[model samples]
Target: MKILACYSIKGGVGKTATAVNLAYWAARSNYRTLLLDLDSQGASSFYFRIKAPAKKNLGKRFLQAYGQLASQIKESDFPHLDVIPAHLSFRNFDILLEDLGKRKNRLRQALKGLKKEYDLIILDCPPTISRLAENIFNAADIVLVPVIPTTLSERTFEQLLQFFKQQDLSRSKLVPFFTMADARKQLHRETAIAMRKRYKNFLQHAIPQSTDVEKMGKYRTPIDLFARNTQANRAYYALWRELEPQLKKA
Candidate 1:
């Protein structure tokens, strides 16, 4: 399976929305897609109208054990799409991974069994550089970072790159795309132009700041399905097209 992680060093940058939307388009393209909500807040699960994974079956012991996650997978409303619900217990992932053997690749090893079942695995990761995050970096084929065109956001993106270099992870896997961009805002337009020039790998499409994206919370669906034919959807489609070459090979 091709693993893609929607990750950022900072939060509130449309990371989860990108994951949900990309997974939707993947499924629509007849690829068996799985969206794994690793954020304990369960926002991705909520967007799909899914409940958090029950506490009775979750804890550090269970979460750390390889291959147990497959048991938590739930089918989504759409065909060829599925999800592994998020749980508050996931907040302890750092501790869980800490006490494991070969800690760095624990998540990667657990996911091996899924290669035959899924074409795409889009991880909606938590915002932090923790042990679990290292597992994600180790596992993902491409790490997609949703960046807001602002100084703080850009700094955080740089921090992510620094972390990758320090950790000896493949920096080539990192792909950044702009989020919440407003053309009317000179800061947004200027930053977008400057950053892309600085970082050759930055994605070309920018998702406009829109209430339509926020409406995903109320509608409990992806932008591709809820706000059809919108500029927001158009940008998401274009973003997916940008990643298509990599995904198509899988």
Candidate 2:
């Protein structure tokens, strides 16, 4: 199975929104998709109207085992899509990973058993650069980064790249795309153009800043389901289309 991680060092860049929408699109395309909400805040789970798994269901290791993780999978309202809702216990992930000592790839190792059941696994990761982030970087086949068209976001994206370089990680696994871009703003427009020129890996499609996207919270579903004809929905569809071939190759 291919693993796509929706991640950003900086939050509020539409990372969770991207993950929710893309997983919906992937399932719509007939792929067996699993959306894993790693964020303790559980925004992805909340968007799907799913509750966090109880502590008892997680066992003493906090569902660190593959079977425990798989057992936590709950079906979403959408067909072909399932969710592994976030647990409050996930807040201890960094500490747990640190305690494991040499097991830097623990998350990757646990996810292996899930490959048989899912065609694609989309991770809704928290915005933290920690040991859990290292496991995500090691596990993901492609790390789909949502970069907002602003100076601060650009700097954080650069920091992520620097981290990858220093750690000797494969930079090619990172595929960044512009998110919440307002073309009407000269700064946003210029930043998009400049960033695309600087980073050849940026996707061609950019999700526009739209109220329709903001309505996902009110609807508690993907924008595609509630605002299918909107530009934001179309952009996400285009993004999935663009990423599909790369996913297959990966």
lDDT of 2 at 220: 97
Judge candidate 2 at residue 66 and give its lDDT.
Answer: 85
TM-score per model over all chains:
0.95, 0.97
Q: lDDT (CA) for every model shown? A: 0.87, 0.90
State model 1's lDDT: 0.87
Worst 10 residues of 1 by lDDT: 57-66
**Distance from true position, residue 51, model 1, in Å?**
0.7
Model 1: which residue pairs collide? none
lDDT of 1 by residue, 127-166 (tens): 9898889999999999999999998888998999999999
In the range 1-250, model 2's lDDT, one tens digit per residue, is 9999999999888988999999999999999999999998999999999999667434226436787888789999999999998888788888778777857688888888898999999999999998889899999999999998999899999999999998899999999999999988999999998999999999999899989888998999999888889899999999999999999998
**Best TM-score goes to which candidate?**
2
Q: Give the TM-score of candidate 1.
A: 0.95
